[model samples]
Target: MKKITPANLVPLLTAALPEKDMAHILNALVQFLRDGGVKRASQRFDLLLDAFKQNPELAREFGTRFHRWLGSIHIYPALVGLGIFSRSGFAREMGIRIYERFMPSFKDLNNLRDVFLYLFQRQNDEKWLHTVSLLQWLSLYDTLCRHSDPAAVQTASRHLEQARLHALEMLSIWVAAEELEPEFTRLEPKLMEVDSAFVALHQEISRLVAHYRSGQTEHYDTAHIAVMMEQCRAQVERLRRKGTGAGAGSSVKVAHLLERLSQTLDRLAVLLDIQTAPDEKECRRHCVRLLNSLTTAAVEQHSTELLRRRSINMLAKSISENTSGHGEHYITRNKREYFAMLASAAGGGVIIALMAGNKIRITGLGLGDFTTAFLAGLNYGIGFMFIHIVGCTVATKQPAMTAARIAEHVEHKAGARALESKLAKLLIDVARSQAVAVFGNVVVAVIVASVVAAAVAAHTGAPMLDAHTAAYQFKSLQPFTQPTLWYAAIAGVWLFCSGIISGFYDNRADYLNLRKRLTVQPLLKRLLPARPRAFLADYLHRHYGSLAGNFIFGMLLGMTGWFGHLLGLPLDIRHVAFSSANLGYAAVSDHSGFLYFLLNLAFVLMIGAVNLVVSFSLALTVALRSRGARIESLSKLIDTLWLQIKANPLSLLFPVQPPAAAGGNGNGGNGSSANGKAKE
Candidate 1:
């Protein structure tokens, strides 16, 4: 007959039983063995164990299956050893009952001890490695039981001492291994010292308990206990620093050991139930300082690594996308349109400036006056035109880019068409709003400038400049001076041409393909090197239109001079003849030409300052409003992305489902998880 041993019974019973039933069987066996029924247990154990002994194949199969079950939770090494003995005759006859009684209770403790020993032993065997992982889990239950029962402190303290001794012995074995060099060798002596200190502490506690049990009063030295804890904390900090400089393998081992040691110390402290002392507080403060230093270093290291990885990953993704067929096409088209618009706007402004300069030079003006007037006119005209062009472009194109990105995100989903529809609507709304704001602002600025000119004409008793110029004939330039009405007609035509160009450029650059195809400033150019020069380049590019607008404003001021002169009003020749001169004359006759010049000077300075401040303030209000809207939109988009991630994390790597569908699933999934079944 086969022997009734712990090893044979364990596999046989656990093979066919569920976890709860297996636990129950082990518990019963432990109780029976503890009751001293070794002989009686032998007969029953042999009958159950024969199935495993009869066929080596069956035994192997059962072992494999049982190991898988044990892997699900922690099991003791002694239990496993006992199970092996159940199949041997001598073991069953001599030690079967004793093994059965103690193995179950000691299972958790033995498993934990084995895991520590395995790390020291440096076993590379797969089976051993798997078994060690299972054992670590079992140790938690062992620690938990001891922590919960105050009355069992004495017993728990004894068990911890034994565990520490086992750990120290294992450390010694590792130190002897040549493969485990300077690091393990250094740690071994320290671990031994710690083990001795802990044992002494345990013994003192035991002595105190024994004295109490013997009806003698005993006082425990809480201060001494606190000092020991402080020492342990200091050791932990030293080990942490050493571990940081150690080789990777040694570092990992040291970190694991330190973690376990910390847990053990915490358990011991709880068992001691030490009261607070002034020195204890000081020790705690020191510990906090040490921990904070280590924690900060680790956090900074982790953050840097994370950022580096993200940057590398983004670059790689961008490179790959640029290489792809569709990606190349999209980029090419986008660049082409972007540059085309920028070139057209800049070229047109240069043409207008050149044209106006030629006309002024032909009028027989001095070089100084011509140069100043040309520069002022060029700045005003170009600045005005550029603002409308760039503002409209940004408003239209930014939304389109955003929409395309969103559409790509949802392209593979079931409701992709619906998503596309919604995105289209959003783009249209953004474009329309932008067009209205740009056009409306331009119209208002023109009207305000015209109204101010009209008011000046009425006050100065000047005929409308347009009327007087029509009647005059300059002998030197009779060919050019057809009529003031003709000049007004020409100005109207130029204004219309400028508006058409601005709108066309703004609309054309809004497409993704067109934006990339224009070689204005590539994303890489913006990204590659940190150059102060590049910032200057971007600034110049963004505000180049403003200079054009300023030139146009100056031209309009010059035109007002002709209107003043044609009305038989005083001319501010010093100030180049503009309606600003009218402000100098409150009394009709006292409005000298020199006073008109001063008036123009003061008005230009005052209006420029006031308009600049008001315009900047308005821009800030617009920017803040836009930021708040963008933040709210981004919040919604982020929530949608998170829902998609949760529904199917793989979707992030490859398109599995649309964001909309995932959002629906997320709401449904959350409801079900919280309330026990998804609604609808």
Candidate 2:
């Protein structure tokens, strides 16, 4: 095979490349590269790159599709491993290029939202949290540049307020939780001491905002901000010591205090100018101060506080914790079964509802005005039962398994290095499962809508027999007919929307929380017992899994309208199906018995199916993607182990030995002998 170059593969990728083919190509490229067919490998690689460069739309579509496929397979771990082997400078360079390509368009709010989301996903796999942090800072800085515009400033002000509110809420939650802990009994006073400091930080931010609003440049002085920050750090330090002490409640109090302090610091950092180099420096200085404060307050100072200690120790414990007993059992027995059962029950309910509603309509029932109402009731009841069963099942099962897997994976001796590789793959599997679930729901919704619509059209002439005219007559029922349809349609649409929103948000949030746990002091301590530096280096790799989830979820959401249309359902049924007939006119025109029941039945099915398919598909895709990522990540991790071993045989024993020296001479023996002995 000829060496594929960026230029050569562009046409193929641009021409709606199939996913299977894409994967095959990638596999081939990998093999070719391994076999020293660099020219062929490069040709293919260049084809992809050229395609991306020449056609923005194609680039976007290809990127999105590729990302989706990767997400579905939970292939982030392999990518992460690739990234790790590729070298930091190269990764950083690619990251920078990505940023440049997308940053220009981010001036628009929607674009900004997209960019933020994109950056968020990038944060998952790329060793670039600091880079992302920088980008976010810059984005905000750009927004601030338009400070001269009242509307812009107002927007910024709004965002700033929201950030503050979030910080406050987090602080409150942390504080309340801490106060309940036994260790906080003695540390209460020390915790209180920092309250004033927090108050001051809040006040300073408020003052800075006011100063900026009033047109006083000096009011945003970095020096004064630095001083307040220093004080906040000192107070935080004191609180840390208090909580870390021997008092039974100290640990709890300290954890709460540190959490609050961290939030406050984050808020403060956001409020400051961070555009220029100097501004960035100031921001970093303050950030470091806050980090130091958190470290001192929560970790170093509270070393003895069991709660505080536990906070730090939990990661390690989680990693090392045995899964052979309850953990494993919970995952396999309780978790999987629960989700599976829920899915089955939910699916069954929808099927039953459709069948029942059809049967009722088909049977020429004599129940006059009550028929439509009865059908609606039946539909809702069935829908609720299905949703409840599935929801409960998912709730009971997946989380425990997820936690257990994470614990087991991170605890293995080689877990830290392997974690990055595995995390992405796991995430991808979860994402794919979630996508499948979403797709399934979409299919169900479409099917139900089509079925109901067909049924309604067919049953336009059923008999209306029983009931007092005053209570159950056509006029009285007329008002409800359209509204009920509207309600169902609206509910369906809402479900679809909710699925998209929740899936993306939850996936991203999970990744961020995981990243935070992995990077944060106590958690980091537990997860990276052998090599903290290696853990940090690989952190970005793990993050990619989450990014993959977000991208996939978003893509799925984008396709909802198209999918709905494909499924033979109207995206908006309000105008066509539920537009209220002239109120006074509808009463006189549509009093016929059979027509109304059919309409009601149709609406019911449409609503039920829409809700079912959308919700289920969203859930399933997420799960699949996450699982796939985990599996792939584990595989790549083995490869990473081998690579590390090959690169430096002696360093295998001393995993903690610095990479710089280990990679340089190949025989440096500082800590290598001890490490080798330990391994032996």
Candidate 3:
């Protein structure tokens, strides 16, 4: 029994082909190229190419059969639209993905689009195609087309030429429309032109393609084609910048469209470059790139991974940018700003303490889980909203907000040294800001809750909490006895989600022009004079997202316990401020001894640590990815941070006295001036 390996298998297949049906053998070879792992496919392809070099007769027989097979199938759709703008809107594309998951489109073997879809439909299929080198890809393609009398091969070239022209025209229109978008126009009115570079570039490329179709041999002037393309590209970048800014109000749909337009321009530019190649060698290299793009594009379009990822990144970046306006205030760059954050967090803590007591009252009412959740949630929501209205900070919510500022800075090109310095400093500010906020919230909340409990007990001759409720609250906060850390992590996730909600609403505020709508609002008109109405509208415009996010976050926190009970799960949130406040009430009401209270206090701090760590890690991960920061840079950042930490550990808990301003007093005067400097 001979063990068949790639070493012997190819020769054996070649010998047996003489006695076998050529059509079946050819189909098997084609299938070999399409399927299997990269190494196996490469081995088989190399073997076939070697066999062809040795025998001309066999090569012709195989080549003719292959192209004849190719000539019979449709290739236009695959060439022109496979990974291009075949799908437009973000919602439509997502719907298509959802539909395909349940009920896929039927594949027609004769159509190249369907055939490509059929061959590489899996999410992981794009990996192998990307790893295949341009030289190997070129070798495989040239071999297939080598012995062709095939009209299909010629038709493919013609289709590519046609696609190039069409892409040029389509890109021009897309660019024109995007530049004319009100926001884009307003952002850069001076960049506009009469013979718009986009339209002119389209005309130039179309002319070049016409020359090739007619077989003209004269030198083509495409020097300015590159210049024109650059102009269009520059404009695209401007729109991207303006679109992602605060109040620019970009959507996933608009972001996706911007990405697709950029891609179309790139592919079109390559096509133009290929035609203007100086020699056969240059032309072949250009052709190799296109050949590689064709198959990779098919695989990508079928997988749809690239489009989905890029669209989401663009949207996430926009969301981060939108919310980052408030994030700057969350970061404290100096001593004055740091103290202000502590004060704000302390204010928030006082309200949270009262809210915790109300939650205790609500829970003791013996209501249904859903009804309990509703009332408790209402209490939480209105309380948090009141805190926001009065200008206070919640430590848990800072991660999502502060992450956007860090992300925006990562995108800046300030040279490697400056970036490292500024980034590390910014990180220090964020860390200290977080520390002070948590310290203020926890300590103040605990103190307030304890004092209130003592006051009630003194007046009413009994503690506010009954024995059972006090015991239950203590049990819930125990880290070792329960999955309390896991619960805290859940609370962190909710905090992150609330931040995203805040950003989305902030973007929507600008997108919907809420202030103008409110100015014309009928209710406002009836309630107040124009001067006062305008002021109220302006205030709501600024705080709309914060108000909505805080309210919804409260609801989520309130509902988790109910949902857990309904599903027979141990799911519940353990936010740090709330847990600390609960501890204060439980200790005072239960009349627990000092030793036992200290033990519970240790657990409360541990819970707070978990809550902050989980929320901050998630927020940072999303923010960095959305900004497309390189892994290399992130590694560098990690190294830089370690150096920074070793040099001055206190910097993470106290202000750095930024080196550039070291000679100066570095007091930062007051909170407002310090805040002005922290803005990116």
The lDDT leader among the candidates is 3
Of the candidates numbered 1 and 3, which has the greater TM-score value? 3
Cα error, candidate 3, residue 46 (Å) = 2.1
lDDT of 3 at 99: 79
lDDT of 2 by residue, 575-611 (tens): 1111111111222223436566455434434444443
| lDDT per model vs. reference | 0.34, 0.36, 0.74
TM-score of candidate 1 to 2 decimals: 0.19
Better of 2 and 3 by TM-score: 3
TM-scores for every candidate against the unseen true structure: 0.19, 0.25, 0.85
Candidate 2: 10-residue stretch with minimal lDDT: 671-680
Local accuracy of candidate 3 as per-residue lDDT tens digits, 1-680: 65335456456556646643344464455566556565556655666566565656555666665555555666555545666654348778777766786888887777766666666655644555555667775675666566545675666555555655555555555555554555445445654655766667766766766776677878589887788889888877877886677876777766777777687777776666666778856766787787667666656664456667877776677778876777887887677787777888888899999999999889889898899999988998888788888878788888888887787787774456668767876787788888888888899999999999999999999998999889899999888879999999999998888888888888778766788889899988998999998998887777888888899999999999889989999899999999989999989999999999888888988988888788778877787788886334667777888887888787788776647665774545335632322211
What local lDDT score does residue 535 receive in model 2, on the 0 to 100 scale?
66
Listing every candidate in turn, what is its Cα RMSD in Å to the true structure after a full C-alpha superposition? Answer: 28.5, 26.6, 4.4
Please identify which of the two predictions, 2 or 3, would achieve the higher lDDT against the true structure. Answer: 3
True-structure lDDT of candidate 2: 0.36
Best by TM-score: 3
Cα error of candidate 1 at position 446, Å: 3.9
Cα distance off (Å), candidate 1, residue 641: 26
Winner on lDDT between 1 and 2 is: 2
- Worst 10-residue lDDT window for candidate 3 reads 671-680
